[model samples]
Target: MASNVHSLSARRTAGKSAAMMPPSPPPENLELDGLDRLLGAIYEGPMESPPWQNASQLLRERLGAAHVTLMLRPPSQDGSGAMINTGPTQQQHVDSYESHFFAADPFVRLPEGEVFSAEELIGPQWLQSQYYREFLQPVGVRHLLGADIYTREGIECRLRVTRGPEALPFDAGDKSLLRRVLPHFKRAIQLHARLDFLECERALFAGTVNRMLLGMISFDQNGQLLETNQEARRILAERDGIWLSGNNLCIDSSQESRDFQRMLRQALSGGTHPRAGSEPELVEAIAVSRPSGRAKLGILVRAIPLGPWSESKQRPAVAVFLRDPEANAAQPSQELVRRLFGLTRMEAQLALLLTEGLTLDEAAEKMNVRRNTARTHLRSIFCKTGVTRQTMLVRLLLNSVLSLG
Candidate 1:
């Protein structure tokens, strides 16, 4: 959501004589132009930020009010509400209102969504009360006009125009303009809330994907990187078999890169082209050679679903998944392997090492186990896991759910 842009400070006057006179009638076209600008600003971002500030300033200038405030009322006694005021507001007045006076203000009691003047709510006798004399008087508030706007989030948003004691009272003309602009203000705020919701959902999905062992990257039709989550960032930073070239994902081998490019293009094109007698199968994975010649970086390119109702109209059209067997193996999932396949902790550790491209002799040396002991674990692993070859065992370990965490 767009955040609030600016705040106001109330100005303290030595004497009422120092205050500026009310602005003369503004040109009608100028007011209309301001409304048009306000509407455009609404589509830019959430109204909590620049739009609210801009609206207040424009309304203040047009209505010739001493100040303008548009904010949400506190929904709960303990909750702070949204506030955007047009000023150079006085800190003293601001503090006083925030501390206590706001709750006592008679304006909140007015009927919702109706424009009313200060006199309509409080008469001369009511104005004699301490809330007015002590709080309103010191703040230089005299006459005012405002209306309430309903938000989609069920918050009561209020807009108020205030005048100084020396200024003319808010008249029908001022209220008329506010009434005209109120609908646009409400719609803009609702639009902001909707956009904010969609943004939150996207973040939640990305977070879940990031927690997986795979590194995920989203790219557009031109292969421009669009988004990469936390795990993807860590993998890309390694600059191993697969790395980013400028903003594009690149593979170490040229042939592999060509294959990847064709696969991505085919997927995005909906696999329309026929190969021999039938449409080619979608390529699911590609292997990139590592500099260490150990475990290669395994990349899986998948197409984002495309349709009229699909969410990818503006988002990325393709996503790439990267798996670093060596990196994921380094994490202590040995206990997980032990429990899943009935292997001892030692045997699990040996299996993890083999997934890192360690030969039988190398793994035996690293684990400080004799050749016979290592071979014994290997035979037991094959029988229990139902995979006879080392290569098959390595693939099984990588594919296992235990490797994800």
Candidate 2:
């Protein structure tokens, strides 16, 4: 078996070299125009949308591949792995591959930074494996180029391009292109995860809070209603000072209600301190005579920060969950380099240090970087980011960028 594998490797190398003969250059203007349109569509929104499909199709077209497949790791137990196929036989090939060959597939297990070649995997020795012979050969798959998609969560997905007998060997240019697009893919996947998580949490929270006897409402640090229990909505409806206006839970308060309003505002503005004592006291003091002879109303407010969700160090927004008192309070760029900007764990830590108002020298000391080298990295960051100053960069990240979510 070992000797057979070696022979297969030799054959694959020869085949790959033979296949490397250059093809005629594609129309640069036309290809660039198509790419621009495709990128625009991809950036516009959801993956399942028409624009996204168009972009994927265009990529396959431009790459001149026989098939393109985007597979997402299943999000839930019952969620079958996501497979978007652009060729007639691709879906069957993928289904068979997943069912039969995935476990023994060498390429799938490759490290995050490396790319895998189909020629290597499709070598004669690999074909000798019963699983590959019976499953893969039947499917007519001859080559594959797979790039890892690393997320803050971890390396959970991969993007694969496949070809058949007519397909050429994957080149360095293909690898570079894949690397360039990988970040965008990562961001889109992350955004999708965030929206899905938020929706699930909102549904669960709404159900749980609505069942509670106490009214509950949640807001972002900016006082925007992040969520509200049904009870909270009902209670707000009864009160003249607070009402639901479109999406916002509007609060009306007078001088007497100022303190409660202020506390709510502070909490909404990302203030971390608990207001339990202050809130109940203010609620009791503000209770007014109602026609029914019950005390008017009061509020209990608390600020909760959703901490980092993954190893990425991106912090989620602060959520202020509240129970109404008679009071109220208030408060409130980037392109590819900006949007695609990512750092390794170490780089992110360095960014955090810098954001904490550290001078390059100080940051280097803290991070144990030599001052000159620290200056070098800082320069790289600035040039890659187009930010002129550390202060501006830090400011950009202060509220928006987090090392993790």
Candidate 3:
């Protein structure tokens, strides 16, 4: 960890030193129209598959190079990093560079936002280096141009261009063009990072809701459906007690439907109704009976939060949460249960069945075991878990974090 920290610090220091240097003036012939097109491609990078494919391809063509590559993440000792290449280089060579040569290559950590050649950075000794001799030589690659980009988001990445041994070395024109576009590339990378973070957070919260077995449904001010999670979609599709009727929620019973609609209207009205001050009116709950006679579906309606000066149209201003009594809550696997309580396979199975509200006899019947054997497993489970009775054992397992797994 200390070595990793030092490496990052050194890289940042190099970037800072490079950034302190003033950039050269843009060339007179540099076409703004082409740059504008490239900028559009760059901004569209975050949404593209393989990210920045079109932009990078355009960049490669613009630079007139054989290959263009982006090291979105630099290689580390742990073998983590991404390298997207727009060349015909064989996959094996790419894999080899990522696995082995990345450490020895001296072309990295280029002056931040400043493009430079391998010859410029390494002087005359560039051709004699182990990385060049063993890897670059074998692949017939010679000329190299690279720039480092650093973003406010702490993202440090490198862009590299390579040409064949016979091709001319990258000149001032190539470097200048790359220098002009490096900032935009940095911004695109930052945007991609933020988008990735948000998607991860969304998935985490959605997964938690699913694990809790709650059916979440959101509605706009007009009581039109806005969003529904997987659980809510399942319940609605079944159409047991409550479902959709042309995007509007409908209850099976006429009286219950009227009550539900009244609550929705009151909630969507921003709580300005006559019953606003009453405790029961703040959050209304109803039990809708199902035609299948399984169990009543629990529904809770509440108003969405509003700002003092908020005035948005067709936005979510009501929330309806549904709970089906017959739906099974997520349970910990038998292996997880065994590991958590030091119980054997049979004991874990019995414990899980009990946690599901099953009697010892019913569990024994399901497991194809005698009732006495089930009782023995139960006693062992109780002793190991420090629970005196079956109910306490159930409570312990039910309250554990294993269910969230």
Candidate 4:
């Protein structure tokens, strides 16, 4: 009876040991349909929304893991200087770790395509290192699974999954799962970076347009206004050229209006004027004429090539300029200041004399005004604006009015 009882106990012990052993081959073929479904969800909307926060939650549910994190190494700094936590925790931990352990981290230094097991991460030798004890263990992380996201711009983003102490070490199944979903993560990272770049480019373009002096008006090939810079809007509004009819630009003066329309028609036709050879001649023609008191206003027409690959080879454009003797006649006012500031008759006359190196007395004499009266007008002009002296005033005026034209 004693022998039989001992035999039964030994058999039961053997059965428990066998059950406790890790499953052979680690179930590497576990179902990946759920992972595919998760990836599909991420791609459903604009990549920015349902951002990393949403992604972390979905990954936690699908992978049955305790936490997940995404870290970014900015080009300006070494190691993972910019870390994003997409896990349950609101604050970031990896950034703090990277700052302290950048030089000691084997995973960061390892080349692409290399893989490491969780045992290697938490082993006594590795764990003894300050980084492991101070950063990883305190956070309840016993195992780590990591992969790299590479970009064409030479940036590397690291994605990591962490498991708790009670959980079994990441098995072959987990590694296989990571391998299958890595491509999706890579796509997400690239998409996110691209969206960020596009936003920055949009802001830069807007800033540049706002800073320009020459009013810029963009039109479709059909002569419909697509967009206008602030300066262009102001000019159009002042000249009564902005029209609500079918979103078209309309000039008030009949002759100038006709010229603008003709120039636009030519531009849209995509026809190039005959040239002598392969080198096309750059030419400007008069498109419109308007009478402003004793002076004539004209729109100068030209053709500019849209791009290196444009089929039209040339795009038609028109620039409006004053043909008034007062505007064209070389005198005291620099051409730019007269056009930009809407200076009064006296102000323009004063500016021209100053630009030609004339003294206050000399300018006053030329203008047939008393010295005291000229000085008074100059003082009023300086005070209305913030210019304190002549040189500074000249610079300010030039900066406000000048353009690449």
- Return the top candidate by TM-score: 3
Q: Where does candidate 4 stray beyond 4 Å?
A: 1-60, 74-80, 92-106, 114-118, 121-129, 137-140, 150-152, 165-169, 183-209, 215-405
Model 1 Cα lDDT, one tens digit per residue, 1-405: 123222212223423435666566779877677778766654553644554676677678878888888765543357555567786687666666766767777777456657888678776665777777888777788777878887657857778888888898877888877887787778877877777789899887776565565688887655678888777889888877677877877777899989888777776664542233354334478888888678878888777654445444445777888887766433547778898999988889899889888999999999999989999999999999999899999999877775445
* Candidate 4 C-alpha error for residue 181, in Å: 3.9
> For residues 345-386, could you state the per-residue lDDT of candidate 3 as single tens digits?
999999998888888999999999999989998889988999
Worst 10 contiguous positions by lDDT, candidate 4 = 321-330
Q: Point out the worst 10-residue segment of candidate 3 by lDDT.
A: 272-281
Clashing residue pairs in all predictions, respectively, total 7, 19, 0, 5
Predictions in order: lDDT = 0.74, 0.60, 0.86, 0.60
Q: Considering lDDT, which of the candidate structures 1 and 4 is the better prediction for this target?
A: 1
**Could you tell me the lDDT of residue 260 within candidate 2?**
52
Error of 1 at 20 (Å): 40
Q: What is the number of residue pairs that collide in model 2?
A: 19
Best by lDDT: 3
Q: Output candidate 4 Cα RMSD.
A: 14.8
Candidate 1 total steric clashes:
7
Report the Cα lDDT for candidate 2.
Answer: 0.60
Off by over 4 Å in 2: 1-58, 65-67, 74-101, 104-106, 125-143, 149-154, 164-176, 183-214, 218-226, 230-297, 300-405
Model 3 clash pairs are: none
TM-score of candidate 3 versus the correct structure, residues matched by position: 0.74
Regions more than 4 Å wrong, model 1 = 1-31, 43-51, 73-75, 90-99, 129-136, 151-153, 270-283, 306-314, 326-405
